[model samples]
Structures are given as C-alpha cells and as structure tokens.
Target chain A: MPEIMVFAATGRTTEQKRGLARDLTDAMVKNFGVPAESVTVQIIESPRDSKAKGGILFCDR
Target chain B: MPEIMVFAATGRTTEQKRGLARDLTDAMVKNFGVPAESVTVQIIESPRDSKAKGGILFCDR
Candidate 1:
C-alpha cells in the first residue's frame, strides 16, 4: 500500500488540503502504478508549537 | 536527517503528544545513534472526515 503522509503546521484551507491529497494520489498512481483506491493520502497538521527545526520550535522561528 | 512523522485522527491530549514525541526521539537516538536534537518528531492530526480507509471516510466509520 502506498500511503502518503504530509506533515506541516496548521493553516491550510480544506480546499487546499483536498487538492494536495488529490495531486499526491495522482503522482503515486502514475509513478507507482497503483490503483487510486489503494493510495491513501493523509495530511497531518500540527500547531506551530508542536514542531521544531534546528533545535528551535516553529512557533519561535 | 531522521524525521519521524506520525499520522492519526485528532483527539490526543497535549501531554500525550509531547510524551509520544519524546519517546520516539529517544528510540531514534538509541537505535540510529543520532543526537536527540537531530531527531524531529511531528504528529500530523487530521479531522475524522479528512482521512479514509477502504473507500470509507474515518468519520463515517
């Protein structure tokens, strides 16, 4: 199963998220040659404070 | 760079999320010999309706 998981800070509209999922699914189906139904795309959004980079929280960045 | 991404439906408490992140970081550090700071854990939470399995939305399940 090809499952695509997207991680990012929260802010995207539902439409944007839907488009992203669709696009990603399309990519996987085209490249991996998997059925669209077998491809699962999940967008995981976190609050700024929950994620960090280079030892600094995203909220602090 | 070892980045850990967790995908799950929303509902976890802040403390649980924090603990999960910490534990995952520890695991990566222990197994991969990566520095604690080098390990990034991001929990991506999706609304129930946004995620689906087996052609059915999680909210509907």
Candidate 2:
C-alpha cells in the first residue's frame, strides 16, 4: 500500500482533505499502477507551535 | 530540506514519535546530506474510520 502523508498547519475543510485523498490515490494509480483501494492518504495537521522554519517557530512567525 | 512523513494508527506514545522523528532525521542526514536541523518528520495519525484496507475501513478490523 502506498501511504501518502502530507503535513501542514491545521485548519483545512473536510472537503479539501477528501479531495486531496482522492487526488493522491489517483496519482498513485496513474504513476505506480497501484490500485486505488490500496492507496492511503493521511493528512497531518501540525500545530504552529510544534513546527519551525528558518530558526523560528511557525507560531512566532 | 527533507520532509519525511509517516502514517500510522493513532496512539503512539510521545517517546515513540520523538524517536521516530530523530531516526528519520538521522537517515536523511546520512543518505541525502541534509542537515538534521533542516529535516522535518511529520507523523500522521489516521483514524481507523477514515482509513480502509482491502476495501474495508480499518475501524471494523
């Protein structure tokens, strides 16, 4: 199974997440010949405080 | 920067997650020569209900 994981700051609508899942599945099927049923998309919502960029926490930026 | 994402069932202990983050970062540093500081490990916890296996939702398993 192809487990696709995406991470971003929290707060996407359910529709966006669903669309992403579907898109990822389609891409896997297209490129890797993986069946749609075997592809999994997991979206990780990271709190700003827990993520940093360029020496600054996302929460502080 | 290497953005490594891992997808697994919810309920890993904090220690396990941290260890995974460090291990992933180390691997990236060793193989890709990316600085450990530039590596990001995002752990995605999928709810059993939202994830399916063999056309069946994990919640039922």
Candidate 3:
C-alpha cells in the first residue's frame, strides 16, 4: 500500500488543503486505483517568507 | 488560476503520477469546486537511495 503524502507548503489555506485531500482521495479511489485509506495528504503551511533557495523566495516576487 | 503541483519524489511510477494528476484534477472539478485547467500536478521522481538526512538514506532499508 502506497501512502500518498502531499506536502502542500504554499498558496493555500488548511481548509483548502483538507478539501483537496478529500477530493484527491476520492479521485485516487475511483480513477487512479489507490485505496482510500492509503492516501495521506499533508499540508505544511509556510509563511510568506518561508520559501527560499539561496535566500531567494519565489512566492515573494 | 491555481496550479496543484504534486511533487511525487518517491514510491510511484511516472504513469501512476500522471493518472493521479488527471484523477485529482477531475475530482477537484467535480467535488471541490476547482477549475480543471487551474490544476497542475508535477511529479518529481527520486532514486531509492536519494532520500537522506545528514547523509543517510531512509529507503535503503
């Protein structure tokens, strides 16, 4: 069983993430053939300043 | 337009990821009130030995 962990760290709210996970789970079950319980989507919320690579934030621009 | 980029870097095939994206997009549209074209899922595949923390790979076990 492959646990699908979605690390959503940007551009969305927690409620949105939950909704997304629900939808994704349903889709995976119905179409992608992944089991309902196997899908685990996690949303790690990042502040507006959190995204950075070498001190440059893509979302800030 | 919001893009749903799914960075799947472990334990899945490319075709499986694509299928997931398609299914996720459809489910988002049908149940979660998101536009179909606004969803963009990207799968970044990683080698089994690529997962590391302080130079130790977890998938090697």
Candidate 4:
C-alpha cells in the first residue's frame, strides 16, 4: 500500500484538495506501478499558529 | 530530516494537538536519535465526509 501524506498550511479550497489527491495518486500509480485504487492520498493541514519554521511560528511570520 | 504527518478526523482540542505534537517529537528524538528541534510533526484533519474506508465515506459509517 502506497500512502502519500501532504503537510500544508490551511486555506485550500475543496477543488484544490481534490486536484492534489488526484494528481498525487496518478503520480504514484505511474511511478510505483501500483493500481490507482490501492493508493491513498491524505492531506494534512495545520493552522499558522500550530506550525513553525526556523524556530518561529508560522502565525508570527 | 524526519517529518511526521498525522491524518485524522477533525475534533481534537488545541491542548490535544499540542500534546500530540510534543509526544510525537519526543518519540522521534528518542528513537531516531535526532535532536528535538530536527523533528517536525504536522497534523492534518479531515471532515468525516472527506475521508473514506472500505469504499464507504466515513460520514456514512
């Protein structure tokens, strides 16, 4: 089972999420030689306050 | 760099999210011998309708 997890900041539209899932599933299927139905793509989003980069919270950036 | 992504249904409180991030970071640091600062934990939550299992949407389950 090939599972793809994407971590990103919140704010994407439903359509964007759907497109990403589809694209990622297609990539896995083509590169990994796996069935599309067997691939799972999960998008994980965090609010700015909950995520940090370079020792600074994203909300503070 | 070791990044941890968690995908789950939405509903956790801020405190729970904070605890999970801390615990997961600690786990990576301990197990992988990586510095705590080197660990990144991101939680992605989806509504029940956005997630599915066994060919059925979670909202319907």
Candidate with best TM-score: 1
RMSD of 3: 6.3
- Sorted by DockQ (best first), the order is 1, 3, 2, 4
Q: Between prediction 2 and prediction 3, which has the larger DockQ?
A: 3
By lDDT, the candidates rank as: 1, 4, 2, 3
Q: Rank order by TM-score, top first?
A: 1, 4, 2, 3
Would candidate 4 be rated incorrect, acceptable, medium or high by CAPRI criteria?
A: incorrect
Better of 3 and 4 by TM-score: 4
Model 2, B1-61: lDDT tens digits are: 7698677868789999888888888889999988789988887686654444433445554
| Recovered fraction of real interface contacts per model | 0.31, 0.21, 0.27, 0.12
Q: Model 1, B1-61: lDDT tens per residue? A: 6997777887887667666776877788789988888877777778899889998989999
B1-61 per-residue lDDT for model 4 (tens digits):
6877677887877667666777777777789888877766666778899888998988999
lDDT of 3 at B2: 34
Model 1 CA lDDT for position B17 = 66
> Compared to the true structure, candidate 1 yields what TM-score?
0.58
**DockQ score for candidate 2:** 0.18
Docking quality level of the chain pair in candidate 3: acceptable
- Overall lDDT per candidate, in order of appearance: 0.79, 0.72, 0.59, 0.76
Q: Choose 2 or 3, whichever is better by lDDT.
A: 2
* Best by the lDDT measure: 1
* TM-scores of the candidates, chain A only: 0.91, 0.87, 0.57, 0.93
Candidate 1: the clashing residue pairs are none
Model 3, which residues run further than 4 Å from truth? A1-17, A26-61, B52-58
